[model samples]
Target: MSLFKKKKDELNYLIFEVTRKCNLDCQFCYNHWKRDNDPKAEPVKEGYTFALKTLKTVFKQANPKHVTFTGGEPLLAERVNELILFCRMKGATVSVITNGNTGSTTEFSQLIKVGVQLFELPLHSYDQAVHDRMTGVLGSWKKSKDRMVGLMKFGAYVVPVIVITKQNFSQVGETLELLNNLGFQRVMLNRYNLGGAVLASPEKVLPSKEELNEAFKQANEIAEKRRLQLSSNVCTPHCVVDPNRYRNILFSNCSTEIRQRPLTLTVGGDLRFCNHSPDVMGNIFRETIQTILEKSSEKYSVVARPDFCAGCMRYEKCRGGCRAAAQQTGGSFNDVDPLVNTIKENEETEIA
Candidate 1:
């Protein structure tokens, strides 16, 4: 027999962190998007050449069908276009998630020409002031808007992201209308994850359960009217916001689909447990994808339904809410997600 064994699960998607350097300072940003843009700033110890070599091996071994280039802003990475082209050469369809602050419209067109099939950007609100304030930068909304329009002109499938927070939750419908008017057929609405900058004071940014439900309600109504396909970034607990209530929304819950999971690779070649968690499970440079999966099998196995979720019909779909959220708030992956369990517990106390 061969030294390496073929794993049961094949990697379908790969999330590649091109760089952590970013320009904008959005309030609800989950990751620490570093502003290391100065010429005087210290250089990265590990060069891109080494990263490229590791990525080549990963692509050859994993052969993921789709790859996403994300970062503080992927455009800031050295020779980013070349990076996208390399992935294209490896037979993976490329998608770039950017802030649209670094590159020009012409650069975006060149990216699409070089086989970047998708572009995902943030458009927080219809109002210019609201968006600029959310990003903590003036004139950013216009820049993002221009890039979105320019990408559409070049026949690129652009998915505008609307992060639902207390600040922009009420304007979800207005934002959806704006995206539809901009000629986008699809949009992604993200629930703010309780991590990074917001971890200190989640209450300041996280939307209440009522706000979340209403936001989804308006989003569904507008999507149905505008014929827009809806998708989400994080999965809300079923108890917090019932998934069945939304008609046009596509909810994402990796916990429910543990066997076929998409992998996230940080810039340093470390494989993160998930998009939300900062925990590193393995490094792509050192281990094959199959080895990482086998060694981390116990971690993945411990993420099933909680005891209270024994007979719940939504267990299969929700898998007791986001595993990262539960681990962050309740201190265990098996613990019930505080986003739901806290509210449910309070209601029971009142009944008693």
Candidate 2:
């Protein structure tokens, strides 16, 4: 299935960071790295008017098909509903990535009523203790689980996002079992990148290739047995698993093309080329969207690929893996993805 298709200049996706305040403290939280310098930084409490105007400008400029609200926790933002409604009014489908424990059922229903077509919920483990530990909240497991079910019952398309890490990699099957039992039809497995709060202790969270492959094997089996749809943000080499077994999980990463189309707007209205990187292209509220896009396009006109990937078979599709991953692992955005090295080692082992 073609997940995303857009014209050369059309912006079809917008990921907005609505706020920087979160109720739960996930140890592997990306926001931690984003806001570590000032944990107490205030949320965008009173930016509703400006936010709405800026969003209208974006809608008119890009005519996006989808607008996703994400953040330290988008539900915590005061005007999240308004933003969703505004995007919907502009002919864009809306979605929110939330921890799911912050708001009441009524509030979530209200969001659905306004225009939230999808809700992305994070579920790290089936074991309550492990989940709670990962989230750093004693009761987060129960709250998040209940919230997921509540949203599903409320008639929202709830997609479980499981971030795979050393702490929860071994529980892939159990986690899928819980998701299957919870009546979820699909789950997205996100590979833990060496960014955010984990950067300080990458060794603790980064799973080895063997562990990741094992997790994928178990997850694929469980998903098939349960007849659930499984997708992954982690771009693995084609030879890692049976192509047919992972066909559904496999995805193309056209970072160079995507970098120019999709726009990430921070809560403060800063236009960022990458969510993981703090580099700001421009401020949408201060400048025109066209100008920001032009500046970003010029700046990222050429994404240099690694020398080793010059003639690799997957070069066209994988585009040298994720640039964010490259930067996090090799300390340079243009460096070869560390996964390439791991995949090469795995290939040698298979031949020997």
Give a tens-digit lDDT track for model 1, residues 216-327.
Answer: 9999999888888998868777878887899789888765444355568876777766665555678877887778877886786545677767888887777777666665
List per-prediction Cα lDDT, in the order shown. 0.77, 0.72
Each model's Cα RMSD: 4.3, 5.6
Residue 136 miss distance in model 2 (angstroms): 1.2
Q: Which window of ten consecutive residues has the lowest lDDT sum in model 1?
A: 32-41
Q: Candidate 2: deviation at residue 58, Å?
A: 2.2
lDDT tens digits, residues 1-352, model 2? 4556432335678888777778887777754244345342345533566667667667655667788898878888777787888788878888899998798777898888986888999889999998888888898888889999988887889999888878899998999999899999889987775556665666677676777777787888887788788888655444443335555464444456544444688756677666554556788668866677776675554367678677777566565655555554435656665656656776799999
The estimated TM-scores of all candidates read: 0.88, 0.85
- The lDDT, on a scale of 0 to 1, for candidate 2 is 0.72
